[model samples]
Target: MTGPGLRREVRAGWSLFRRDMLKFRRERARIVSSLLQPIMFLGIFGLGLKNVLGGTGPFQELDYIQYIFPGVIGINVLGISMSTGVTIVADREFGFLREVLVAPISRLTIALGKVASGVATAMFQVAILLLLSPLLGLTPGFVQIVLLMSAVALLAIATSALGVLMASRIRSVESFQYVFQFMLFPLFFLSGAFFVLDRVPPWIAFIANLNPLTYAIDLFRHILYGDIELGELSRSLLLVNSPAEDILIIAVISVVLLSASVVSFVRME
Candidate 1:
């Protein structure tokens, strides 16, 4: 993996990355729709529930908007990263994917480049959300924001890999959309984004523990809520896993999914 061969592979991956970013930039409607859903959840739903959750128990005295802010960000990243698979289907339909598959580069490099592009797009959306955090009453410190973004980048890698895996053999955009929606809603809802894991039934909690986004959202909470004062019950309800455990789980999942995506891409026609 050295010499001119290595250099050529790098260039190929870079080309793919650049082309995807440019395509994403040109899709203004996609950019707006991607950011819009999360904002609505954070604003309308959070505020609506703020009063309802104020009375007692774990949610007592909780600032619902501030509490679910990280969760909204998690859902945003989840949807955007996993939806990158849709682009692969589009490329396939237009024969662009076939052209790339025949190119002189390892499938590993191609997969990595695609995952990187998806991660870049998801993070771009996250940066916008972070900028609007203050308006949403979440004034995280500069250091906290940096750490949170870094954590989220790791999460994005795994999710984008999953997207690549999903799109690997699918040839139709219509089929991809149906499958994407089927998985997207369950993953987002079960990830503890809109509800507390502790409040769910044992069976549901068991299922959530298996979700990668669960760990990612918990990791986000650790970074974003580090400075905020929270009650014991609130902490219990929010931080599902310790930061160290969350990192370990997400890192392993990312490695496994990345490897799987590369294998799937290589096997694709």
Candidate 2:
């Protein structure tokens, strides 16, 4: 604790990551349930809606399932990653987090560790969805596959930071549910997950542009389609700016939220 160094942080992060993974292994039912819900959404909602809606627009030539695969992956990342905050609350209520708080490490290290573990679990779920995408008519190239994975990692990190920030603020389970409902739905709806941003109203478009999840969805969509450049949407009248710009904004937000969360956790201790 005398001086924070790269090696110290990495070691601390890995230790916490391993501990959380072990806890998750013990709660296998919860893990499976969390993963299954998204898979069901992909199968029922994506496939079922495809039957009714038909095909994607000019910008996207993929089938319904393929088009939404990116969005589905983003959703899984957002949902599972943000839920890690609840584990912190549970740890606090059960007195386990108190011991961790007193440990000889920076609170930032602890927060990073928790976020890393959550991201890992979320990535696992995303990978499963990707593997099953072929049945949904997705035949992404090797490059698209790599880009998709990178996008998932970025999203997982951003969402996890937001979760840590929320967990630091909320003190009870009931309040957590209320906040989760208030925050999660709006993020998903405004993210252009279910529809194109151009199809929405101007006011809603403005809000969607501001949502970090919007950048995430756009990034995934850009990679999946391989025909459209996400940066163009950002440059157009929709006022999304550029893909790099959105990436920078998201990165800044993640860092700020994460730093604030770590400060709050340390203060609480």
Candidate 3:
């Protein structure tokens, strides 16, 4: 039998989930902007850089736009998913979180519900971008498409957890915006989002390897093109030494971050 606390937590999660959905329903402009930004990046940067980087070896024999679509998609998912934390902070400032906290629900449930809502919204954004990927020349078979979606879903969940953790630690929206800008730009730039990692300097490559975003980008690249050497991909980017090892690392990281965020939220006053 579940304890009173556990039941309250579950009920609170449902309530928070409904509230988040309603908030999104009211913010139609933000929703449209999130969906449009990725598409614009794909059309402008992806295709615009295609010609100049066309002869580059890593991207050789493939259209540059097609080669980079997976990475771009991954970046978009990361940004949108991570940005959900802003909403949490906004709620706290606006007294919505305070009202919710007065209820019997466990803090962990509130955190989980926020992350789940963010992940759901991110998945929807990804779906919209994916539908337009064909215009950018990404045509995958049924199984490949499923694999791609799975990879993005995993990425979304991980980033959402990270976002929740960040939100829990910050008290003000202004502070969060500054911190997020600093955190995300470096993470995105260090990642192989716009260029091949191997071609980057040794120091930069080392840092990129340490960045979780690199592993995510590599995983998505494999799913998209299957051009990269699985052995090199596994070792250099993921530091896992094998495909199974890489998957294990990603699974562990995602689970740990998610759990940490939930626990932190539970402990929050």
Best by TM-score: 1
Residue 1's C-alpha lDDT in candidate 1?
90
- Candidate 2 vs candidate 3, TM-score winner: 3
Q: What is the C-alpha lDDT of each candidate?
A: 0.86, 0.75, 0.75
Ranked by TM-score, the better of candidates 1 and 2 is 1
- Candidate 2, residues 1-269: lDDT per residue as tens digits? 44557778788789889988898889989878877877787788777888776643432344566656667778788888888888888788889887888877778889889889878888888777778866865567888887787778877887887788788888876787789879888888788777667768889988877787888877776666564343443335222346677567777766776777778766764
Runs off by more than 4 Å, candidate 2: 1-9, 55-60, 227-243
Model 1 superposed RMSD (Cα): 1.3
Per-residue accuracy of model 1 over 1-269 as CA lDDT, tens digit each = 98999999999999999998998999999999989998899878788987887555656645778778888888888889888888888988988887998887898898889899889998999999998877766678989988898888999999999999989977799998898888888888888887787768888888788888899989998998777778887788778788999999999999999889989988887
Which candidate would rank higher by lDDT, 1 or 3? 1
TM-score of 3: 0.87
Task: Report the CA-based lDDT of candidate 1 relative to the real structure.
Answer: 0.86
Q: Name the lDDT value of residue 91 in candidate 3.
A: 84
List candidate 1 stretches off by more than 4 Å.
none
lDDT of 3 by residue, 1-269 (tens): 28876777777788787888888889999989887777777778777888787765645556667756776777888888888899889989999878878876667777888888877887777777778766766667778777877777777778889899988899999998899888888778787777766667789978877666677777776666653333444334322234455455566778988998888777776
